[model samples]
Target: MRLSQAFQPTLKEIPAEAQIASHRLMLRAGLVRQTASGIYTWLPAGLRVLRRIATIVREEQDAVGGQEVLMPTLQSADLWKRSGRYDAYGPEMLRIQDRQKRELLYGPTNEEMVTDLFGSTVKSYRELPKTLYHIQWKFRDEIRPRFGVMRGREFYMKDGYSFDASYEEAGYSYFRMMLSYLRIFHRLGVKAVPMAADTGPIGGDLSHEFLVLAPTGESEVFYHHDWDLMDWGTSPLDPQKSEDLDALKEIVSKTYSATDEKHDEASWQNVPEDKRRSGRGIEVGHIFYFGTKYTEAMGVSVSGADGTAFHPHMGSYGIGVSRLVGAIIEASHDDHGIIWPDNVAPYRAAILNLRPGDESCDALCERFYQCDPEGLLYDDRSERAGVKFNDADLMGHPWQIIIGPRGAKNGMVELKRRATGERLELSVDEALAKVGLN
Candidate 1:
């Protein structure tokens, strides 16, 4: 994309309200703009990253046999009332009234609604197990919505629901999701630790929260230093048939980790002193098995093989899609700007026309463009060399290819790695090859 024609409103100074690194960098780079308190309009660049993450999440879910569906954002209060959570839900549940004076709610989560949907569709034990998921916008009215999109009142989220006939079978689905989520985060170049967590309002005894250690995280977490040593993603997931629950528990049991709520001094003492690393972590994903909680409450029952009415065992998984943008930055950014992973970076490389109007520089940049380069943000703006350099660094693309008259004379262009500030002078063809534009 050409910078001259792009709608990036880059700011020289940080916004007064942006008090953290993620918020500051997001504003300075023109990735997003505040539409209101805690609500944002994702500018082109920001939308690109958001979509990339959403795609990865969807791919992982599909790989594990999850079917996708869309649910209404506005739901009737009747469902919540049936689940006995209409009054239990706090102010965050954005309550509203239609012109008919019917109580409606912007769903904070889709448990009750999904239960109502699933109950109407399936009625036999043959379709005992099914997994449904959706990527949609969710609204939770935060009293103090700050820290940019990190704690936004309105945000996009990917939520998945699982239904089964038995508690043991649904627990397997939880394990499958845990394994799938590990790969999802690894593909995005972020390491997440699956720590046992308390199921807040989601109502489940068994839950795990995927935590990404970030300096600016809200909750302090304690864990063993070898959290990354386990290969959870490579583990087998055979949810259709029976699996060893004890073996899976053993893997998670090896790690001593918990959010502050579950941190126990006795358990922490059991680990070697050197392996203890207590720090703050951002909650990226949560998976839980809440069997018969909403299904029975909403009367979502199906006939079993024994010809008896049975409530389908159920589970729910969630990832804060919009909040992850800030969490990623928190885990992987430097002083210049956000160091985006290649998988999520808007553009893999930035081709800077150092001498924009110069004949040789413009000609070479035009050739690069003519070649239909992949993932290149061509900066062909008529600006000073220093200004271009600073902006390129601020954007923090992985590779920077600078074309100038001085280098064009020598048939060479400067290639620099954004993360390490390492540079190599290469011929036009070599520069193209280095960035895979060739």
Candidate 2:
């Protein structure tokens, strides 16, 4: 993508309402624009990052036997009413009336709707243990939505539902999802600790919220240092194995991690003083095992082995797809701007033409850009070197390929790593190779 033709309208001055690093940087970097209170229009660059995050989330969900399905953003209020939560959900839910005067709502969450959908279809124990998921936009009427996409009223999310015939089976599904969420965050290049959390309106005895540590986070968190050393990617645990799931669950139970709302002083005292870690963290994902809460309330049941109708245990898992964009920025950015991880960056690298109109410089940049045009952002704009350099840093591509006239004339270029301000002078081919463009 050429900067000259790109629709990224980066701001030099910070927006007055942006209170956090992610919010201020998102606006300054031209990732999104506020269209209404708590609502945003994701610009091209922002959309790319959103899509990449969703893709990683989808892949992880699929690995856990979750079948992809698209649910409606607007749902009939009858489902909520049947689940006995219509009146209980409160003002955060945007209740509405259609032209026919029928009640409807922009779904804040899909527990009731998904329960109804599952009940209307699968009807036996043989089809038990099915998980369905979708990546879609969700709306919640936040009284005061702020902090950019981090707490936006309307945001993209990946929510999944699991249905099982027994409590034990549901437990397996819950553990499997915990594993999946760990891998998801790991691949997205963030360390999100899974902490025991209250179910709240979702209504579940068992729940865990994945929180990414950041100085600007809203909630204070306490955790064990072991969380930092563990790597989910190399774990031998398989989702289909019951023993493996139990082992995973055991590790989680033994770990002392919680938000301020659920912190236990007695349990905190059990941890070794040196191993205890505390910081502020932003929530990016949540998982819950509500058992028969929705199924019993909505009269959803599947046939048992004895041919008797019984409510299937259920669980819901959620990842804030859009909020992750901001949460990631909060956790990863430096003074310059967003330091997008390799897997989720909008572009892998930015190819800067330090002298755009200069024939040698333009040719070298063009060569680098052509190697992977789709994955590289080319700064071909007729702007000063300072302007290009600043924008490249502000956008925060993983790498920067600098093509200045002096080096371009000698068929050489500079490769700079965005995370660390390390630059290397190399041959044109070597520069491309370093950025994985070759």
The residue-by-residue lDDT of candidate 2 on 283-369, one tens digit each, is 999999999999998998998999999999999999999999999999988888889999999999998888878999988888888
Instruction: Please report the TM-score between candidate 1 and the true structure.
Output: 0.96
> What's the true lDDT of residue 438 in model 1?
74
TM-score of each candidate structure, all chains considered together: 0.96, 0.99
RMSD of each: 1.9, 0.8
Tens digit per residue, CA lDDT, model 1, 252-361: 78889899988889999999999999888998899989889999899889999899999999999999888888889888888878788888988888889988778888
Using TM-score as the measure, which candidate wins? Answer: 2
How accurate locally, in lDDT, is each candidate? 0.87, 0.93
Q: Give model 1 RMSD, 1 decimal.
A: 1.9
Using lDDT as the measure, the top candidate is 2
Worst 10 residues of 1 by lDDT: 237-246
